[model samples]
Target: MRYLIMAEGEGDGELLLGRCAAVEGLFTDPPPPPREVLVLRGCAPGVRAEWLGAASVVGRTESGFEVWWTLVDAEVLSVAPHTGNPALVDVTIGAGVLPDDWHRHADGPFVRFELTTGRGAVRAVTRSATDGLVADRAAAEPLPLRLVGCEPAEPMRAALRKRRGRHPGYTELWSLDDTGRVMDRRAIGFDAEWTRPSVLGGALVDVLLSVDADGLPGLAARPAWRLWRAGPPQRAGSWRELDAAGRHAWLMLAMRRERPAGPDRSGGEYHLAGAGLRDEPGLHCAIGEALLGPGGYYGWGWDALFDSLCGGFGLVPPFTLVWHDFAATERELAGEHDPAAGPGYPEELARELEERGVTVLRA
Candidate 1:
């Protein structure tokens, strides 16, 4: 959900990444943030240096107990003999360390680290790998993607030219909703380039960002801006006019809620009109309208919905939510996310409301 890029946090940055189909890493799960190396003394002999692939290694106890480690997705550096004691091998890792799983493979070696379990005392001479520990590998470089468009902002253009491609450094970017609400912001590292905009038909999009990552936030599914650009919905059941994708876009906008300027509007007997309920998004749209008139946002998704029940969203808890025609609404939202297990969405929501001190009347 990229709005025209705004410099810093406000005003136009005068750049358009555009609503292109999902870009790898750009929208989806971004790579984990870069981290420092974590060292674990008394990595224990139970760690199988033989299992050490070209990338990483892990230590374990005989019973297969888990490690006291943090970084699980780590790169294996080497599996050479301990410099001090040639008999004992050391498995040096980088980027991250072993996983701290509650239970590991029963047959695998029980793993432990000195930082947590070891407590600074030397446990014992570690067990030896049947095959000697002997693996050394250099880290692979991150592959950068190329961007071609009407050039980036002044500062971004300069950075691209200066770096020419390697380690150009990172910058913070924000994901905006249709209403220009900041959904989320992330500091991403990118290697940019100056290239002719790829022309298809008669459209042009600015492209000046590229980076490698595992799982960062933002860059969610693109929205159909036409809905909000015409202005916020004013009539009830406005969500019914759009197709499923548009309705989902509406719910997403609700999820990226605008911070209420004043105190929240809580405590009410909100009446929900279920006449237009045909899908999950319709339910959320109706709820928002029921809570705070048309085009209002209470919350979207389970966690956000629960938080909305607490307070701050347009309408809050300690109120009565009279859901009319709920039977039809339930049918529309039945067996969602999973038809095989758990109650229907309506019941789930009712339970959540009841727990939060909201009275739910289903009709």
Candidate 2:
């Protein structure tokens, strides 16, 4: 049987499966997944995971034939399955949740199996993993995430409050040429994206897809968390305070006004894939980081390089740079301009982001 694995783009599309190959007994010893599984790109070839080392298989797991990659564009992923129609199987992959073959990793594995199929020939199955593969990188502690049932806007509201009480309050309005706009704001919730500053000129913060050596999945869950200096903050409960929203809002707003909204804003469906900032190449566009405008803006200082790689890797379509918001404040600014800025930032931080490989728009 020919198994088809569909994805937004052909290049990086295989990453989802590649990770599955990394496990010790997965693709090799025990033949982790059925060796017959096939993979394909669901979107246009020119527009896939061409950057951010899209082809790199950074992490893997044993139990579910399940794998991991950097946060994937949940929006693009929604349509990907339909585009290629993984003939015998119709499984959906996205953020936070595990795929069919995950339970094998459990200490006290559950007992249940689910399989189904739509119009396609392949079958979609969800079951408990009896024998799972274990990859070296899949070692990060399971995320200690808490879900809150509330309007997405509420997190941003709380983030703003935190930013207000913090130092270097939101007083100025930084602008990106036309790409987007941002302001001084912050909030906290489940994801780092809660109360995220305006991004892609109000397009909304799109979840970033990433996989690191730590074996943890990272996303811009909340806009508020986008500006956090550390990983997901430590807040417990449905209604609690998060952290600062960061300081790129004003700079972002300045950029948005300079440009117009993007073309692929909507697919006219209630499902999220069609609305807000569409994927572009060589540029990582986020909603609240005051990042990326009509051309491209640099608001997600940390995500800048990764996004660039995402764009370059073809996960997103190609775009141009219209503006770059350069601001770190008087005291926040690096003491001196070390030509080797990229090297200074930790490798685990953004990897080779600052190296000469990427293109940054200078003020």
Candidate 3:
């Protein structure tokens, strides 16, 4: 959306600039100029005013100063500013009719205008929408990823720092203890940043063995970042040698699989082609029936399979998930069984089982 700003009387430019600054300050990351602005006229009629409120304001003019402000929907102005100047009245201007061009613009609803001048001269100017504003802004600026309250192991910390060095989008690390004690912090980047809870959790698990082997007892991490903890140190040479919990955790870190991205008609584990039938409907029906049968919980999805392995679905321990005709099953589940699609169910189920200290096998 676009908004027009015009000045008519003496000191008009200064007034317009002040108004623009006030409006721009509302956004945490103020957008660039020549961009759409939303103006609230008297009462902001017909507009949702939940984030707005009205108040009177006095500002310097060419003569001495002026006291004027259009009444705004109190509700709409309430939450408008992210910080500072709780008084929404400071950002408002005197009453004026919306320009005729406002209705003509294709993105008219989003565009607004504010004319700062002597109360008498108000004119409407029409112009085409400015192309590339949105794309230009996005390309010029990318959102950052902020890491706050991080207390990673030394190696883990180095790894995180390395990632930040490689990616300019990562904000400076905020080094804090697990108990929310701040050791060091740095400010960089705008306020808006993408946060992925899983990223920290995954990192913690990757360095779990190191933390334990160093004899660092009482080691704790932020609950939100501790997705999976490492099991006790083990010297199991094979899956059968480790205890149940150790085995589960090992498998979780080892096995992982990815599913195909697109649709395929090769059929899944319960397809009827293996039964010598070529009918699609018959195959689908058989597949559905098998999914509802014993040990069929795996058919539901990754979560269900994990639950079954943990005996959450009443399945006993010493569970062995044998993928009969492994290659064919892989082809059906992960289109053509592409290795790039990932380890598929094995990886997913193993992770869940490991989290819960449940042992299971995938063959």
Candidate 4:
């Protein structure tokens, strides 16, 4: 994979310098550092200078395989893969200069990089003129120029305002082959550890199915629980009035039914006791707090629910969950309440549970 960067203006070079330096730290394992740094000048007409270097470090990071380099004050920086042999040049490009799209809107100031792992391949090409970057892969793809983790550089952030909210709010774990092609990709959420191939593919599928036609996943609403007096408030016609244990039991049953019958089926039973009703009131509030934890996935909205059901919170399927006070639980869910309690909470829960074939039973 060849990465090219081109920068013009006063601070642009300095920015590239910092970014490249950071990348150099990516490869810091057994591989030894580059013994020689090469500098090339006047590579092309109107092109000022270029720098090339090599690092032998190779290892795994929380994200994926780490491989990168630094190019300060250079029009180009070229990188080669760490094959025991040093002759192979895997990446070659000018610092801050990205590749030109098939359509050439301009000829200057771009950033381009390619990453290939065992899971899949990602190629990004962004021209400063356009003000955004586009990264692509087979399974998980983001809206053009949408930054996932930290915010992007200044002008780019301003240009991406319209598309900024489109980020999936999760990181996609990827692995690359020796040749720099991405082989696998997995979508991971907060406080979650990366599992094997199954988790990767499963998470991606869950996201795709839950998202709207525009590919944006459902956004979370308000928190389902609010403190009132010493205990939680019970809205006149809401699921909050239901017995906590009973509601939890129903949710467990619903979860079980929602899954397909197969090897993955849990086939076990879970029980929720109603003893905590004084402290936790509504079904949504109790379940969100108990299962997802305080301020976790509670009342965030559909995406959070889907993510929770998909095991983002560490709960997997195939088991039956039972609760006492089934009738009281049912009444609360079917009751009327303000949207603040999450409008359509019951309907959405029922719809998803019914789809999965999860069954609820009262003891």
lDDT of 2 by residue, 1-363 (tens): 011111123554421110010111101111111211112223222222211111111122334443322322221122233333443222223322222333355544333332111111112232323112222222332222221221223323343355331112111111111212222111211122223322333433322111121222122123332322132222311111222121232223222323344442311111111122212211122322223222234434455545534533222323222223223221122322232333222222222432533332323
Worst 10 residues of 1 by lDDT: 115-124
C-alpha TM-score for every candidate: 0.51, 0.19, 0.19, 0.24
TM-score of 1: 0.51
CA lDDT of 253 in candidate 3? 24
User: Model 4, clash count?
Assistant: 53
Would you list the rank order by lDDT, best first? 1, 4, 3, 2
Q: Please report, as a residue range, the 10-residue window in candidate 2 with the lowest summed lDDT.
A: 17-26
Candidate 3, 1-363: lDDT as tens digits: 011112222543211110011011111231222322233332212223232223222222334433232322222222133122333221222221211221232331323332222112112111212121112122223322333323333333333344232222222322232343322222232232222333334322211111111111111212211221222112222232333333333233222212224432221232112232122222222222333231122223344344544433323334333323433433444421225334643344345544664342333
> RMSD in angstroms, all models?
13.0, 23.2, 25.8, 26.5
Worst 10 residues of 4 by lDDT: 17-26
Better structure of 2 and 4 per lDDT: 4
Q: TM-score of the candidate numbered 2?
A: 0.19
Off by over 4 Å in 4: 1-268, 273-281, 290-303, 337-351
As a whole number from 0 to 100, the lDDT of residue 187 in candidate 4 is 38
* Model 3, runs deviating above 4 Å: 1-299, 336-338, 346-363
Whole-model Cα lDDT per candidate?
0.52, 0.25, 0.27, 0.30
Best by TM-score: 1
